[model samples]
Target: MRKLWPVILVLLIAVGLAVVLFPNGHKSLRAEKGPKPAQQSQSRAVAVEVAPAVTAVYQEDLRSVGSLMSDESVQIASEISGRIESFRFSEGQTVSAGDELVKLDDALARAELVDAQARFELARANLERARTLSKSGHVTERAQDEAKAAFETARAAVELANVRLAKHVIKAPFDGIVGLRNASVGAYVSIGTPIVNLEKIDVLKIDFKLPEAALTQIFPGQSVTVEVDAIPGRTFEAEIYAINPMVDVNGRALHVRARMANPDLILRPGLFARVTVKGRETRNVVMVPESAIVPRAGESVVYTIQGGKAVETKVTLGRRSAGMVQILSGLEPNTTVVVAGQLKLSNGSEVEIVQTQSPSALEKS
Candidate 1:
């Protein structure tokens, strides 16, 4: 009876263990069979902004910074020394060619001219009398020759006096605007004294330099665009009228000069200018927004939507202008490209175009 008591005690312990482990085994089986909570699916399509690669006329231009200059600029200086009797032009006045600007005291010059004229007349009368006497053999040939020589000398002296009198008046060399007067009336001025500055501002000259390699693209009569910092947001059209034949030895650059019409005289010399020389026109070029380009591993790339997925494409680049880039190759006309949201994209990325921008809008970006 004691051994049977031990067997009963062992049986009770086994049952207790079974009771404790049954629920855990059932829970594990249910967990394995239960439909796993559907994995949270990732959003498939990436929202992106797109723009079309369009065909447009693209111009290759040479750009440079330079300065504005007058078509003709000169410092007005006195040619002869004298006291200014009167000023015919006011400061900052416009004058025509040959218009008198200053008048010096001509009293002495006038008197000298009168004396020369009187002497010339006396010499002429004497020469006539000497010729008449010589024809009748009343005067010797040598005496007649002396009289002729004296008359000729007096005539030359009279012409010299006239030139001296004209020098007393200073005239404008060309039609131009005069700067502020440097001398006042009654102020004595020496030769080469600065009177004023004269500038022909009806047309302005733009001087700039470009690399000597660009010489083949530049020529006379080519169109140029000029922008001034003083007058922002306005571009002036000009033409290349002159190009320096020799390249600057120090800079290895070719100097170029362009001309722009300024009938209103708004543009002045010495202003800073930005110049663009239009070189060649390429028609039907594939152009894309600058934002579309992604430089990777030393190559430029853009994403184009193909089969509703982003297809990474490698593109050859050309001239860039105004927030736009010229795609020399690797893109077709009218192809749509992702301009925005490129950071989240990969090859064959599903794209949902949230917005489409116009070609002109892309250009202005």
Candidate 2:
């Protein structure tokens, strides 16, 4: 019985060793009892939403600072040297053309005219007597000729005196508003002495400087829109009257002048204004938000969505304003562009556009 018990103990140890070494065979012997792994659910891809492109007409405008001036301005000066006897018009008063504005002393000039007239009468009488005597051989031919020459000289002197007297009254050259009077009544003024400043303000001339690149577009008779800081909410329409032929050597800019009507004279000379030169309207140009413009390798580019991925596109640009940039080439008007998430975008990265209320929300999707 003792030998039988030892054999049975060895047989049990061998069975335990076999079960530990081979578990699959042991599980089959143990009625197929085993722990099973839990099955994992299938994963889903993330949903990325993208906005479709929008089509809109982009308007471009140019802004520049300019100055307004009078259409006609003249610094009036004395024509003849004399004492100013009277001033016919007050300073700052509007005067018509040919209106007498100043009067110089003309008593001496008139007296000279009278003396020349008397000398002309005496010479004419002598020439007539000499001609009559020469016909009768009582006067020599040389004497008759001398008398005729004296009469002609006297007539010329009278005309010269009349012209000198006419210069005493200085008249307004044009209809304009006069500035400050430099010469007062009873003051002596010389020829070419500045009397007052005159300006025609029924219309004003606005002048501005533009870069040489605008030379081709700036021509005579082009329309311009003008805005003055002094009078807000008012816009004046003008036409390009002139353009400088020579470009400024120092600044490389061309000067332009435009005429603006100012019937109320509200637009004063020397007032600063904002000027816009209206070019021909361009149509069907591709545009995107100015913020989407990116500088790469000395060129401008923007990321546009294509085939569900962002693609970098190089574009030629033109006039830009109002938070919009005009794409001159390499882009279509309906091409979708990355507007907001450009910082995290790559060439082929997926983009999800966040839907939010925008100014153009009412537009078609």
Candidate 3:
């Protein structure tokens, strides 16, 4: 038992010495055998095609798909409840402002006006008598004042009756083309009930969405070419009239409005149109090949060659034209970017520029 105790004591002393000398001995051994650093893992040079991100004149046109609208569109409706007595304008007929389009039963409105006129005449006579008597000190000033107020009230009633009678005859609010008729003769309709559609189509408007960034790039009066699908092979000219002040939060875009003239009465509202805005003024911009852009996690990234290594950079992309894309930000001009073999490359990866090429030259090829 004593011999065993000496062996156990010696083992315990050795174990205590090891713990005090190497507190992380196992960790050190594991570290020595662990995977290599990221750089060493990608030490082999990946063969890739390279292109210089050069400064280029960017004047690409802004194109959008949109719909045409009427310069003025309205759902023609009645202002008062009445039975439709007659339709003055035929279906699909052109109408001018103040032209009677529909007539309702105005018998009640005329009777009301006549009654109001009678009362108005009586009130005027009473006011005149009161004023004469007041001047002679026969009637009190209070009676004269009451008579004057009564006269004014009757006058207002007459005006009100005229307004009501006018409502019985519906007129065109503007020069426009009338759409299909909804009500027949003697069909009763209430206020705001749609009778037909009136559209000012001599001049047309267009509505489309554009990137919010375009707010500063575009302006009113910019010329654009519009191609309507219904009318093939014909390009109509249009002009930007306005831009919406508010931004669409969900789409992050701006609503743009434009106007187009239809002198021959050819172009119309409610037609699908493809609008191509004229190119902007020439300005220097950083451009790279589209192949350089790598999408990562819903973001655009590019590989810039620095010291023969791929340095991953996030870039804000802009207009793409002729196989090249504009780098709005996060990249500088004259920087070398990888155009090919990007799929096998990672950040800090060693690369060999197997072929140096220009994006524009390659696109032409």
Model 1 lDDT at residue 161: 97
Candidate scoring better on lDDT of 1 and 3: 1
Predicted candidate 3 versus true structure: per-residue lDDT over 126-178, tens digit per residue? 99999899888999999999999999999999999999999999899999999
lDDT of 2 by residue, 218-297 (tens): 78998899988999998999999899898999999998989989998888899999999876556666666676777888
Any idea what lDDT model 3 has?
0.90
Regions of model 1 farther than 4 Å from truth: 1-52, 213-218, 233-235, 277-279, 304-312, 334-337, 344-364
Residue 232 shift from truth in candidate 1, angstroms: 3.6
User: Can you tell me which runs of candidate 2 are displaced by over 4 Å?
Assistant: 1-63, 306-309, 356-365
Least accurate 10 contiguous residues by lDDT in model 1: 35-44
Root-mean-square deviation per candidate: 6.5, 10.4, 14.2
- The alpha-carbon root-mean-square deviation between model 2 and the true structure, to one decimal in Å, is 10.4
**Candidate 1 lDDT tens digits, 1-365:** 98799999999999899878685887888888876444312376889999999888887789999998989888877777889999888888889999998899989999999999999999999999999999999999999999999999999999999999999999899999999988888999999998888889999999999999998899999999999999999999999999998899999999999999999888999999999888788899889999999998999999999998999999999889888899989999989999999989999998889999997776566
Identify the candidate with maximal lDDT.
Answer: 1
Give each model's whole-structure lDDT: 0.91, 0.80, 0.90
State the RMSD for candidate 3.
14.2
**Candidate 2 vs. true structure, TM-score:** 0.78
For model 1, state the Cα shift of residue 352 in Å: 6.2
Q: What is the lDDT of residue 221 in candidate 2?
A: 91
Candidate 3 local lDDT, residue 38: 80
What is the lDDT for 18 in model 1? 89
Shift of residue 252 alpha carbon in model 1, Å: 4.1
